[model samples]
Target: MSSPEQTTAIVDAATDPARSPRSLREAWLALAGLSAVFLFEMLDNSILNVALPTIGRELHASTTALQWVTGAYAVVFGGLMLAFGAVADRFGRRRTMLIGLALLGVASLATAFVSTAEQLIAVRAATGVAAAMTTPGSMALAFRLFGADGLRVRAITLISTVGLVGLAIGPTAGGLVLAVAPWQVLLLVNVPVAVLAMIGIRFGIAADAADELHRDPVDVAGAVLGTAAIVLALVAPTLFVDAGTGSWVPWAVTAAAVPAAVLFVLRERSARHPLLDLRLVARPLVSSGLAFKAATGLATAGLGYLVTLQLQLDWGWSPALAAVGMLPQVVVLIAGGSLVSPFVERVGLERAAAISAAAVVGGLAVYSLLGRFGYVWVALALVLVAAGMRVVGVAAGTNVLRGLPKERTTIGAALVDTASEVTSGIGIAVTGTVLAALFTGDLAASHWTARQTAEFQQAATVAGLTLTVVAALLVGWGIIRGRSAPITADDSDSSAGRDDSPGAEADAPRAAQHAG
Candidate 1:
């Protein structure tokens, strides 16, 4: 009963000598390279955040212009990831990744010569383009490097841990570097990272085989429509945050996204060779994985934004103190990687995903209900959410790639990331809008009266609860959908001679069981 794709994946894993790495030690070089790519993605924006004010002063840039310096990167990166994922699958993952690393190095070096905010924005966008090209490939390449499910989970956990460490330290590291070097050094550091990534990947991983590469022509029309829909969706959240609910721009953008998405789905359904095969996505494992990832992203982003605001604005903590206060979450994130493999082994992948995702919901609920009482509640909330995020991040992504065919792994990775990115934006928007609606007066004011303080806490609670509700729904659906037969070598053996056609009606149910 196994689907053709699932059957092929098992056979390939069982038979392929090329993907021989069974443990992290066996593939350190290639993994190190992929980890570097992930580090850049997580660190770039975070490191730049600390230097934004300095850049504004040095360049005499307006507030709006300064925002674009960061925004441009996010917009371009989120917009192009899916398209580039498809491209890498067709052409070559290694080839595309090396080219992207080169572009990243060049773009990072350009920071030294950026004399204006506009120039900086352009450079950031270029890096974003580079990120789109390479980020998804990192996960895909890592997955492809290993044949066993356990090794895949461990490899992804290792890479994600490195990235999480970078994210945790970025702002503090940026601050330290700024004291001794120009702001440009923050970006210029990427040059070395990119160089190391190139060496590791080029020397460590093998080139793609002819059979692994896609043979069909790229779906240009689907690409265009998909990109447009994602771009508009990303832009709408920012508009809601910046322009407020009254602004017509965000509403207009949101409206435009619906039609673009519809058109893209329609085009894909009708296309000879779609950019993203909707049929694959319809598989329970893929859908469940995406939903779990989306839930984590939403809760993580929302909780972080809300907590930062409460720490600095409501409690009157210094920026340094607020950063230190967030250390619990950071510590748990970096340390929790060690727990993922054991937990998954003990409980199984689907159960681990469900439990961890529920933990995220639980953390949000804890904060919503008890965060107003004391700092202890806030720290607990952060720890719970961080722990859950760490596990689910690895588990959900592994589920997705495992559910996919080997040839389509890069796009599968891209879909996982896109789900996270889009939902993170929505998370921020939902919390921000709720805060805006319930709390009156200047949020950035230096001092707040007792009434303002009370209103802020109320707003935070309402916002947190709202986010928790939304996250719960996502997690609930994921758990329900994820409940299928676990994909295993045993199933593959029994179903090897059965109908392995893509058009088989029973394929989805059979494939769903295999994702675990």
Candidate 2:
């Protein structure tokens, strides 16, 4: 019994002549489901950011412990995404989605009730794993349902919109809840949302099997190595900082991670069944997409943290006010994502992505000098950065998904999500560490005397400027590289030509053919 929306969607998909009505319909449902699912994910992402101060006060946490509240979730979340991508391939997407949602809902409920920092981190980690499982599957389902050049643009737009909103709303929502309801309420909010999404999937979605489910063995080794490499990369800085190892720890982690990654790549290349098909991702479109996404994450995530600090510490705004000030960012994000999507599908992905990446670089550059200006100027700069970031982010995801064969959608999505998480975690740690260090130095420059307050303000401005420049450069590189790359797939073609025979994965060339 499909819902009326589903029925209408299927009918429209069938009769529309662009593609099957059923396909369009499923795309819409997946869009809605993914949007809802990402709301929870992003909610969790920013929720911890807002609650950190409160959690510290209540739990008497040290800085190391405080970091774990965030780090724990990230480590588990990112580590599990690739593994879950395989699970989605093995099981049906529908069942995986429902089960993942259920686990997330339960974890959220438990998170709200937990009392200690350890308890919160543990519960959040569990929730992160659940989210990892659900996120990649949502993407896989999107590809399966939408097909190439079908409803992908609209779906990505909707997902981007939801994610942006969730990111924006998290701080305010968490603050309001903390004001009236306790930290637990933040965790509990996922329950109702998950219940609704469960209902939606069960009734609205039909089960989908991966196209080559039986042909390939799961690449367990690659999965482990990939997850370890990413997680180690994210945690290395923190480990260096926490262990008081100065410079050696991060260098060591980097050294280890590089070889592990190389080994994983070699293993993936030769293995009969790689966890992810490396050859496909090695394509210009896919590689560029991953790089673009990572750059965008580094820029926005770092900048967002800096802005929050500026609002709260320097401007003396409350959490609620800071959150409200960021509302404009959310609007810009959705608008930017929505604005670029149709053009991406029409003009081709690489061109569209390149344009968006340029916008991001340009925006970050424009905003770079803003910290020394008045609040209004800074606010305007934020809007520019947000809009640009939204555009690039959506284009990157759409391009990567389009470049992959349908069966590799989950793996590709895992790469996308994992890169995003890993990059963001680095952004937060690096930006936060730099700002903290700068602030401390400024305080000392004042001789720990009467000049403390004014010096703090100066430090904040400097920190913002520093981050703006770094973000600008990262985005600039992506824009230039993205322009030279090929777009993902043929806009007019379905993947109907894809061979489903055994070893079909081996037969597929990457985007290079399209480039030529």
Candidate 3:
């Protein structure tokens, strides 16, 4: 319930662009803080990947232990995102994010003292928990800062660009650093990033208002179910990549996910205060945006995994050369942020989302049909997918937030990220499974026989085509669902009607007071 004055203030905040930050420059500190949060998410995994062998050597770790070092992070991060999103919305997004940043700094600092694989894995898991708390808040806060769609798009673009650069250069940078310094420096870098993010967010953003937070009791049952479902989902993909397709372990894990997901949905439907309101998610725009994001994630990750193998294992390129070959994707992801605003302006957000999503499918098609012909086709596929991913990443996320109630923006952002993370895991699983099924003999052998080469090409083609069809269906569904009329802030569920009760009156002014 809210008073008329609170309602008016909320509406004014939604409709008035003049009151919002005029430009990225005007809100540079806040944006910097948000961008730094994103940079940590993107850079942490990529940089550490290059140091796995070094870590194993120094720590005398087994292969399984090394896998957990990265796997633990992904599992913990993905598993906790939705729960944390709900927590942030109820308590305070800023407070939760700042706390998460501090935790990230502490966890990263602990990496330097790690002497065992188990210890390192524990540290990575801590960082993942921190990431889950902070990452969604970044986008939620940015969306809250701006009233205009244009400004929001630009802000997201700027933030994503910084993250993309971090992701693109992480491997190379890690390699260079490992040449001269200890691997500990890589994780240690997050301390400074966490510090900067804390300063900017603490000072630059306004505090949360009472009216901006939901007062309902937290749905503990729903949170547990949701976390279990997501954890199983994220884990199944890695199991597929590690264990062969015939292994019953991955199948059992996959089967467990179905029940967990079903139970989560049931709990949410019945919960007095569900972690994620299913009704809101079923809204045309939110569902469609998630579909688009999932499609892009599937295509981008699947293609990257396959191409890396094709270049190195099949084409006999050196590790450094294969890394160089991936520049097409890296370049586009880093440079394509500028294109998002203009493209969205020209085609409109919905159209841009659809077009970009289609391009991802199209890119997969190119790789499937012609990649074996030469490096040129693979590079083209990379560019197309990267270009599409760059646009849809921002557009789809914006659409999801736009469709959600202002108070639920953090969960909406989490949904966007969760969809991407889950599907990317699935993507890698699909490609790896197909390759394993089709290609025989030692995949990692330095010298492959002619039959193995032929088998590898066949496996890649089949995998690529499989991804293309799946991505196309997802993108097409998204476009169809997204065809529904757009939901503006004024007409959103939170603001569409006024509450006239006396109790509501007191709540309104509190919102108005913190409207800035």
Off by over 4 Å in 1: 1-19, 484-516
Question: How well does candidate 1 match the true structure in TM-score terms?
Answer: 0.91
Q: Report the poorest 10 consecutive residues by lDDT, candidate 2.
A: 507-516
Question: What TM-score quantifies how close candidate 3 is to the native fold?
Answer: 0.91
Candidate 3 Cα deviation (angstroms), residue 372: 0.7
Residue 492 accuracy (lDDT) in model 2: 15
Model 2: residues with Cα > 4 Å off, grouped in runs: 1-30, 48-63, 112-115, 148-150, 210-214, 239-255, 311-321, 335-338, 342-347, 428-516
**For residues 183-235, could you state the per-residue lDDT of candidate 3 as single tens digits?**
99999999999999998787667777776788888899998989998999899
TM per candidate comes to 0.91, 0.79, 0.91
**Candidate 1 lDDT over residue span 1-516, tens digit each:** 546654444344334536455446546677779999999999999999999999999999999898899999999999999999999989999999999999999999999999999999999999999999999999998887765566677888999999999998999899999999999999999999999999878866778877667877899999999999999988888898888988999989999999999999999999999999998887667889999999898888889898998899999899989988998999999999988887877676777888899999899899989998999999999999989999998888887876777778889999999999999988898888888888788888978899989988898888888888989998999888876555445323322122234433223223322432
Candidate 2, lDDT over the whole model: 0.66
Model 2: how far is 201 from its true place, Å? 2.3
Q: The CA-based lDDT of model 1 is what? A: 0.85
What C-alpha lDDT values do all the predictions have?
0.85, 0.66, 0.86
